[model samples]
Target: MKDLSDKALFALVQDHDERAFAVLLERHSGLVYDLVYKRTRDDDDTKDILQDIFISLWNNREKIRIEESIYPYLHRSAKYAVIDLAIKNQRVTAYQSLLAKQDEPFCHPAETGLIASELQQQYEQEVARMPGTMQQIFRLSRDQQLSAREIALQLQISEQTVRNNITLALKKLRLSLGSDQLIVLLPLSLYISSALAVN
Candidate 1:
């Protein structure tokens, strides 16, 4: 197994051969870890993302094609996994900034209620217009206060899928409600982003 080519190992993996999978991991994990660590910098995040990459590889092994080499496939997967971590981290920072700004006075009590109500209505309308899956994902993350991991587990999907759906939902809501309304929704967004970050 150790002497087998990547294509051969992958073929065995596709056949559910655990020894082949182990050989492939032994051969490629160092490179995958290095690629992911370079992008992440944080040891903890790198470890988590590296594990995710392998889990993803195993989950989608049947669909993977190995015409020439497996290096490109592993490289691309590592890159994307790191990118997803980066995006999630950026959202956490943004959410923290927005949370800090929440301390400053923005409006009078009466105006605050009116603005929040209007924003809530617009948010609901925009969500209603989303695809059913997107709406469910958004609600799970936002309204139900579930972490991306939690939502992913509940829905039996990848965390990336949950994040993508939430991102799309936010984009659609922003486009429909305008950037100005984002302020009113900041608290909710912050909550969701923070939840995702922690998990």
Candidate 2:
């Protein structure tokens, strides 16, 4: 098992051989960690993304085809994981920044800082009302700045499920926040619309 090639281990992994999967994870973890850490520069985020990659590998093992070393696949996956984290973090930062500035003077009365503060409270209330799992997913995305893959790995769910919950959560927020809130929030309204459209 220790000496098996990536292809060989992956073949066993497809067959549900836990030992083979463990071997593959052990053999390639350092490489993935190095790649992820270089891009992310945060140890915790690096480990989280590393877990996401292998969990992704194990989850998708049946569909994954490897002709040689899994190094290439792992490398590509690491890059994607970093990109995923960055995108999620960017979205979180943008929205949080908007929230943070809610008290700053903006435009009219309803669109004023007071209204923005009220909107922030209202948004939190809406988030609190979300279904337990969806709320957890949303918080992980917004507060912890974790990607869908990272959230899924942490929650032991599929990435698609994580994405779906996030989409639904955002939709709920849009509806609850209303167009008036959007008008007051400036950029977040635009971000929300674009995010929903893009997702």
Candidate 3:
């Protein structure tokens, strides 16, 4: 129940206790999502990754060795998953680009541009899912390139409130992003870094 620690729950799960597995999932779902989101920055990928993480844990349940904190084990698994995906994506993108150049004298620019734009929109919507006030503050500060004080003045809130909102936004964003991902594109990295500087 509420008194059980993660270690105990994990131990039980290793012993084939289904309730323990449920508790483990409930406890760490956000962490898993955060890691996946940080890695893929795609809703569908995140969902897939989340499912994969749990499936992996279940499949390897008998072999899990949690002598210390269970968090690092989860973190390590999430990180390796991201790295694996990133490598796969790089290979796929490169192959696609090569095939496109070989097949077409002119690249199909519109189709690619539309897909990129849709992904960007999805990323923004994910950001917006944080607390409403934090979302507003983050958008104003990052997208508008406004300072915290300037945001406070425009929104008619205290400067400290602006600062707090930005901080909360970054924390939530970072937690959602998990630990191992860094946006590789300069513009996207700049945008995400500015919005989630604290994380």
RMSD of each: 9.4, 11.1, 12.6
Give the alpha carbon lDDT tens digit for every residue of 127-190 in model 2.
8999999999988877776776678779999765875687677678778776436444423211
Relative to the true structure, candidate 1 reaches a TM of 0.52
Per-residue lDDT of candidate 3, residues 100-148 (tens digit): 7785644378987776676566566668797778888888876777765
Per-candidate local distance difference test? 0.73, 0.74, 0.67
Better of 1 and 3 by lDDT: 1
Minimal lDDT window, size 10, model 3: 184-193
Ranking by TM-score: 2, 1, 3
- How well is each residue in 75-162 modelled by candidate 1, as lDDT tens digits? 9888887777778679879977886788665577998788779878878887898999999998887777788778988999986688
* Preferred candidate (TM-score higher): 2 or 3: 2
The CA lDDT at 65 in model 1 is: 89
Which pairs of residues collide in candidate 3? Answer: none
Which sections of candidate 2 miss by over 4 Å? 104-199
Error of 2 at 48 (Å): 1.2
Q: TM-scores for all candidates?
A: 0.52, 0.53, 0.50
The TM-score that candidate 3 achieves is 0.50
